[model samples]
Target: MTLEQARAALAAARRVAVLTGAGVSAESGIPTFRNAQTGHWARFRPEDLASPEAYRRDPKMVWEWYAGRYRNVTHAQPNEGHHLLAWLERDKGDGFFLATQNVDGLHARAGSERLVELHGNLSTARCEACGTVAPLPEPNTFTPPPTCPVCGARMRPNIVWFGEFLPELALEAATRAFEKADVALIVGTSGQVYPAAGLALETRRAGGVVIEVNPDETELTPYMSYSVRDVASRGLAALMGEG
Candidate 1:
């Protein structure tokens, strides 16, 4: 469908569900996890740094790596794509639900209220033993292998590690949104990740219209009713009649 058609569909739809990925934040200069710099983190694969085994073996190294990422995301501002979604939520009210695979807090910073963060946020830290969670400490300084003051157990960034399950609440929320949506707008994701990728299919299976916005064809392309091969920020803006 054309941009005009998409806009009309969006304007007329009662329930819309949106899913985003790293490509959305890439516009804001946040490096994708797989694209870490060759000099510093290239030596250590993301899988190595983002696993329970790695944290168990060398928590300090994992902490240091995540600390750098946290700092980067804290410094980067949300881009047009984030603001566009926020605006959609503000104008469309409860009919719109957004779920993101990005760990950066860009969607929150952009003022998206009804959002589901499937990958978990990078701005929070949690105690491993007691499950006490808190915003990352000030001065952002953590003694390598940080310890929780509340329980004296190790502190780790509250993210879903490689081998970890996606947060149950987030998964449930996204699934519910998918099941209820009349239109599902999937953006920026390659649609390769399990569960998140499964959303597009779920929506289609439930008889919802699926619209995909990305710069390239994704695994969801075949299932989409409309595939717009363009930058997400631009495509979404156009689709929302803001361009």
Candidate 2:
């Protein structure tokens, strides 16, 4: 009944918004931030590599850590969940808005264009001086601490660090979309993370239906119009299947 209800709402709705989390990318074998720390990396805390202070202390170490992660995502292929969202964007066209907390860039690889990566992507780097965003050198040729071509300044992984806030433009656009959406899908997130997690509420507050798709119940489950109980691919398949 829950799945049917969500399917009905989505089928009829033209303005749709979606928010994806780490679980979507994890389905493709990309480990979570903590899960990536193994072997030699097991000794360091997350704050040591992901915070601005950590970068200031040792930019080399920080870039090394990110470089490994970049390789991991670069090698990964988009899964069924990613393809589903991308297909959804093609259907909705101007009415679709997809936002993701995951920085793996799988959504983009899956062909989702009208999307916002709430966090930064690992496939690219941002210059420290000119703030120019550019793709990383090819995986084999890449080295840590890349320099900018525009201003000749040091480049850092284009990621949102622990102490830093999300990019204002992305957040604002997502908020606007969520507020105006006719249906909002919150997929594969624990809802423990703030601001991004709060996006579902924006849908409900604006009289839009909010649906959750996850294998387990999250904090946001109780408030949703319906919650599909499964992982991202299977859960989304159930919601969208045969409809």
Best candidate, TM-score: 2
Error of 1 at 35 (Å): 1.2
**Model 1, span 50-157: residue lDDT tens:** 999998898888888888888888889999999989988987798889999999989999999899888888888888899887777653564445577789897788
Q: State which candidate has the highest lDDT.
A: 2
Clashing pairs in 2: none
How well is each residue in 1-243 modelled by candidate 2, as lDDT tens digits?
Answer: 367777999988999999999889989999999999998899999999999999999999999999999989889999999999888888889999999999999999999999998889999999999899999998899988899979989999999999899999999999999999999999999899867567999999999999998889899988899998889999888877774
Query: All candidates' lDDT scores?
Result: 0.85, 0.91
In candidate 1, clashing pairs total 0
Question: Residue 90 in candidate 2 has what lDDT?
Answer: 85
- Per-residue lDDT, model 2, residue 113, is 95
Worst 10 residues of 1 by lDDT: 137-146
